[model samples]
Target: MSSRRSGISEEEINELISKLQSLLPETRRRGSGRASASKLLKETCKYIQSLHQEVDDLSDRLSDLMSTMDNGSAQAEIVRSLLRSS
Candidate 1:
């Protein structure tokens, strides 16, 4: 194949292979070194947990404002009315 591609003789291919081998060490098979599904899932779960906590915190703050509205404060009711209309 090499002989036809570069017009080199079969003898040249053998010589080239030997020369390359002499100059470089033999290559070894590599390990996968890939992340496991559990590792990925744990990271994803952590990210989702942070987002969920943020949403919960925001909901709690909104709930506090909503609770204040029930006390019949005129300014709070106005804000609540505006929020409902929007």
Candidate 2:
């Protein structure tokens, strides 16, 4: 898939992998057993997909909030104009 504004950067992916490695048991960290390449790739893809969804959701929410604030401000201005006329 093409990279988007919400896409994870290499640095972020590396950080995530580092954190995951830290959480692994000492034996696993020492390479007694390792996750398969396919499994790791699948997990990473899932994580990135989740991040994209979260970013999109937050963006939509922020847009809605801004629209609400703008409407409120417009209404307040109308009310102030009416009070001045009275």
Candidate 3:
């Protein structure tokens, strides 16, 4: 099939766009086919960044909880060393 964007076939591009649209919230996605590729890409970037931030927050919370556990686990031991060294 002839490509509309050089190298990448138009079908492939459309498929990628559809996936991107699915990732975005309904409020952000322009369902009318009027959204540009750049706009879609920008939204996807923001969405990914937000997800990364969420993951980081959850990881920090998990670390804090693990370190506070009284089970004498490996993670608690590591945290104990850091606290004593301070």
Whichever of 1 and 2 has more TM-score, that candidate is 2
Instruction: Judging by TM-score against the true structure, name the best candidate.
Output: 3
Give the distance in Å from residue 70's predicted Cα in candidate 3 to where it truly belongs: 1.0
The regions of model 1 sitting more than 4 angstroms off are 1-36, 70-86
Residues 1-86 of candidate 1 have per-residue lDDT tens digits of 45688898877866664443333222112223333445444655676688899999987998887776665788787877877997
Give lDDT tens digits, candidate 3, residues 1-86. 46853798777888888777777885244565646788888977898899999999987996778757976688688876876796
**How close is every model to the real structure, measured as TM-score?**
0.37, 0.45, 0.64
Model 3, residue 22: distance off in Å is 1.0
Q: In angstroms, how far off is 86's CA in candidate 3? A: 33
For candidate 2, what is the TM-score? 0.45
Note the residue pairs that clash in candidate 3: none
- The most accurate candidate by lDDT is 3
User: lDDT of each structure?
Assistant: 0.61, 0.63, 0.77
Compute the lDDT for candidate 1.
0.61
Query: Which of 2 and 3 is the better model by TM-score?
Result: 3
lDDT of 1 at 31: 29
For residue 28, what is the lDDT in candidate 3? 47
